[model samples]
Target chain A: MKIRGYDKENEEIKLAMTPMIDIVFQLLVFFIMTYKVTTMEGDYNIRMPSAAAEPTLTEETLEDFLEVRLQADPETRFLQTIEVNYGADRQVWNRSAFPVRPAPGEDLTAAQLQQNRDSRKVFASLNQFVINIVGSGSSDPGSGSEIEAEIDADPALRYEDTVYSIEAISGYKDDQKRIVKLIEKIKFRDTTNQSP
Target chain B: MRFRRKRNEILEGDLTPMIDMTFQLIAFFMLVINFSEVELSEEINLPMSELARPPEEAPPFKITLNLKEDGSIKYYDQLIAGIDVIKPILVREIRQANSDGVATSDVVVIIRADMDARTGDVQRLMNKCKAEQLENFSLRVIERLR
Candidate 1:
């Protein structure tokens, strides 16, 4: 007859707890390294303008809209010009043409000349550009009579600059103290050829 | 005289608490981990915007395209060669989005680009998306005051 202690030892099953614990610990480490806590990071959504069919907008009516071209200065590598095209006539607004503070008795420079010459000229602020594109007149405000603006920006332009342009164009209040959306509709023109 | 201890004395401790604590930790990690981070590239630094607001509703279908400062594109954690390579991939994705009877217009294309990325690269990508008739596009930005 086998002894009780020997029989118990033979029948008992042993689990290697150490290896299992090691594996669990490994998994914990993996999760810790790869884990990311999600936050409200992606808050901004921009609608991409397309040539697709829209029930309300027809091709013939869109031909008369305004077009703004943002071109980067090869030298400064910044948005140097704003070319506004209204029915084939192009007016270039130079960034350098915007005024800077002159000395108390300093002679007027080119920028100040442009700023003073044309009441509609875009001054140092982007708001001026917005105003020029969307008429500053408050009369008959909140009416949906304004034409859509098409923005064609160079591919070399920085993302922030483009956002600023978009913000300026989209967020404008009309003269009636009501939100008169000047550039209510915006279409991004494809300047993909400029990309390297 | 010195007393002798018993040779076969069983020494036991409770393992239920240790296992419980470890399992709890595993569950915690799993719950807090975000799988979307895998698709986001670290090279791109998102821009800031004052108007940016958290999406009101979760999009039924969404795909994130990461564009680095150099204009290199990353989709689903893979680097695509150029617009040509990404074209077919987006077409396939649009088809996949429509799998559950959702329209192509309903699919949201999230553009996550570096602040220094060129507008041209983004436009090119947008053109491709437009070609596929995918209209909804969202540009991701960090929320901050102007």
Candidate 2:
């Protein structure tokens, strides 16, 4: 017999990949099946104490607050006008003043585009007017903090309009995409018994 | 003369690149997947706000109430018909919070109302929560992208 080491040819050992590949595919399928796309949401905070717990407000305290009145149409329940009262100063903005533009990439008919701008203009104007009175919070923090915005909306007004008004009064985003706080305190003037 | 047959040659295609790509895809999907989507309701179309910003951190104890256009309240997949019906639920929630050592004022009540819903209904819902001593409220809205 010759030497065993020199006589035997080298053999290749193969590892099984089918099982590993199957498991990896299964994991991929599971994740794909459970995948979901959700939109981003944010919140506007409000502290609403019950009417019974609310403290009595003096005339001076009432004068310090900014009153925003939202009036809606009786039949359509559409916002018709916005009346902003600051002490004795008052301004009224009509719903038809500002035209609502279609959202980015949104397709709309001419009639829909022409439809009353809802509360968009009044809110924008309200924001600007507030800025004029309170000054930019980014520049001066104390003034904005001291003022409270009391939203007095019509009972039948669409909730969306009320939200839009709140968003306008609360704050605005700067060019840098940072929020500049305006009026932090907001409350709804009880409209439970009020009619449209 | 003696003839020997040669064994058929085995050929294997390279699978390493394919496996690498598949793993990358799975990692991407895992990173982007949202598991907390159950709290959001698809039926209520939230109004968009340009100034609304997502909170830096979620509140510890929070309840979400979805208000539909027809004045129905959706709470954790349960459809409540009117505001009056939600009072009992609010009481139970407050009791649960109190048992957990959390004050009612500390708990946040998130309201996601439909764009077309009446403002009166939303106020009524808030009133019910107020009756339960839940003072903190959050009006949830979609972030309008510029």
Regions more than 4 Å wrong, model 2: A1-15, A97-106, A109-119, A136-143, A175-177, A191-196, B1-11
DockQ of 2: 0.65
Model no. 1, DockQ: 0.42
Off by more than 4 A, model 1: A1-24, A37-39, A48-68, A81-124, A127-149, A170-185, A190-196, B1-27
| Candidate RMSDs in order | 9.5, 4.4
Q: Tell me the tens digit of each residue's lDDT in model 1 across A1-196.
A: 8776885776758676878888888888888887765445654454554544544545766554767788875643456677777665567767653223378899877767766445223322454555564564334435433656778887687776666566556554445534444455666864434434
Best by DockQ: 2
C-alpha RMSD over true interface residues, each candidate: 3.8, 2.1
lDDT of 2 by residue, B1-146 (tens): 23333234456888999999989988988887887777778889998888777878888788889999999998877999987799888888888888999999899999999988998888888877887888899999998876
Two-chain DockQ for each candidate model: 0.42, 0.65
- Candidate of highest lDDT: 2
Q: What share of the true interface contacts does each candidate keep?
A: 0.69, 0.82
